[model samples]
Target: MKKRIIAVLMSFVAVLTLSACTETVVELNTVSMFGGTDANRVVYESTIYAFENEHNIRVKDKSQSSDEEWKSTVISNFNTGNEPDVLQFFTGETAKPFVDAGLVMSIEDIRKEYPDYAKNIDDSVLGTHSVPTTGFVEGIFVNLDHFKSNEAKAYLDKDVWTWDEFKALCAKLVEDNADVEGYKPIAYGQNIPHYWIDHLVAAQLGPDYYNVIKGAEGEDKLTNALLKLSEIKDYLSYDETEEFSSQAFLDGKYTFQLDGSWFGGRIELENITVYPFPVVNEEYGSPLLSGFTSGFYITKKAWDNPKKRDLAVKFVEAMTSRETLTKFVTYGGGFAADSEAKPQNETKVQEALRLVSPRADFVVLPLGDASVAGTYAGLVEVQASFVNNQADTAKAAVKTYIEGQTD
Candidate 1:
């Protein structure tokens, strides 16, 4: 009888242990970072910390990977059901595949609960990516000290310049400083053509290029935009053998370069000024807005935990508030989502606002056909060939490459 009692007690203990194991709290993890490390990640951290404390939730913040590395890791974890609750992703057609595959969770419903999340944010800013995403603008950064007098302010103050006016100013600046020893006419990176393409498209076709083109040949505007891009080849630095455009610009080797506004903070330039990419078509009279999203995405692997998913939505909503969005964008060196928030860094912030505010019809969109992963890769290769005097096949090669990609 004692032995039977002992066995029964042991079985009861085993059952309790199993129940406890099943009930153990699972800590949810979220990874936040851009494709590369920078101030953006810092802002994300601050925002996440505040959110975690408020919600009594835990988030595992992981960041700092090359674009390729991030892509590979995100893809690997997703295929194996090991993805973090939230992962940083680029906004555009590129985000569609994962979203379509059911790898990303839609936060539209979440956005509704927190109206402030969507209120301050320009609905158009979300673009064609996910139903809800974050985006930053792309434009020229000016080193204000580079200019000697108020005359220098004229070009910057024009608010908007047609392509001709902008090119002429760039040429004038280069020509005026030509006699200065050790001056680079323009600091540019050849590894990517989207900056140049964005400028040209904005100039030639306005900002709608990102949303208008379903494919390469759907519209004649693609060809027209390509022609304008071909023209800018003369202005860009052929010697971008260096990987970083901001570094080259900071070193004072080049007068101007095309980069995201975040590059403004990468270096301390008290003399810096930011401007919109020049408008190419005077008739169209529209601002070409280069925008990118900085929103969080939920991977399918995290869907198993509905609580974690809800927490993720809450965190995103918290980060996107008008006050927080403005703070992040201001600190991160870009235009604020809320116009009234007023950036403390007035000069650069004002430049950004002026670039986007007027011309209500001005277009804002991402650079590539979101569906095509490597459309700009060929553009970069072609640019390199042009600089290498391998011009004979560069244009044809790019044209052929893009042509072949379509079918």
Candidate 2:
């Protein structure tokens, strides 16, 4: 009888152990995602927190110092087969290499599962960034309150203006507002190349940059664009002599500066407003525009790990969701790539959208070629040369730079 009791007690203990094992919480898988930028950090943090609360999973988010650092780290991890489950990568030829390298997994299946993809993201944006994969939208940020209707009408109405017209407008603003302390017409610093690569290229080329660069014999057109850009060298901003564009905008100095929409709220002053880039050559013909969009890519290894893959997709969906996207734009300031993510306050968001909206005659493409940084650097060189009356060498300096970029 005592032996029977002992056996029964042992069985009871085994049952309790099994029951405890069954109830043990299997932690939902954790995923590491890549993000960069202050605005991105804020939006991503909120999104991740929301996702974690909803799904009982922890996210390891790593924000890089810069876009380049993010790319390098992601690419290195991918090569080592230890890439983050999700990566925030820029769209275009820049991303093409990774996709071609078999590093990025195709999201064709994911897109199909989410039918709202097309409805939310515009077709043009899809063509540029995603159709083959996922696409992105590049948003140009403009300051509205600084220019106001009196000064902005000319640029916005025509949508596109010649290089001469652009310079004339800047000069006119400076001339009109000379009494205002440190009131420069516009500002961009030596740090970025867009003043030349994106904005000035369209005005300088007097045609679509894509048409020229993708042409069979595109050198002449490229050279022409280079020359035309050189012509308007004076109009470009000088951060040192003038106020930094962001500082100037904050100080109510310049009418405008070209930047990504993501920078809208942080850099925007209470009195200042935002808009898109204007048409480059409205009178003659619209010039091509350029933009850069940012998004996430998943790795094949991530796919193999079902939990990791699911987590990654969930993160992407969460981050790019209508709700999250709206919040992102509200704080971040770029055009909502998602259909459901339209601006909450039209007055604030719409103004920036209108500036970058597609026009019939105008075109938009990516900036940066082999000599990508040359245009801006060259512009500064020529501007200094001109200001100092070093005319003899300015033309030669410009020629050397334009030619140097191709080789």
Question: TM-score for all predictions?
Answer: 0.56, 0.56
Q: Which stretches of candidate 1 lie over 4 Å from their true place?
A: 1-117, 127-135, 149-152, 182-184, 191-194, 207-223, 229-235, 243-248, 282-319, 326-336, 339-371, 384-395, 404-407
Tens-digit lDDT track of model 1 for 213-252: 4454534554456555445556566555546655767876
Candidate 2 global CA lDDT score: 0.54
Misplaced by over 4 Å in model 2 are 1-46, 52-73, 90-97, 106-113, 118-197, 202-217, 226-275, 280-293, 303-311, 329-376, 383-399
- The lDDT per prediction is 0.58, 0.54
Which ten contiguous residues of candidate 2 have the minimum total lDDT? 128-137
Please report how far candidate 1 places residue 331 from its true position, in Å.
9.4
Residue by residue across 3-112, what tens digits does model 2's lDDT show? 99999999999999989875652233222223434564676777778887887666666666455665666567667766666666666556666677877666565565
Compared with the true structure, model 2 gives a TM-score of 0.56
Question: Worst ten-residue run, lDDT, model 1?
Answer: 126-135
Error of 2 at 39 (Å): 6.4
Candidate 2 residue 305 C-alpha distance from true site, Å: 6.4
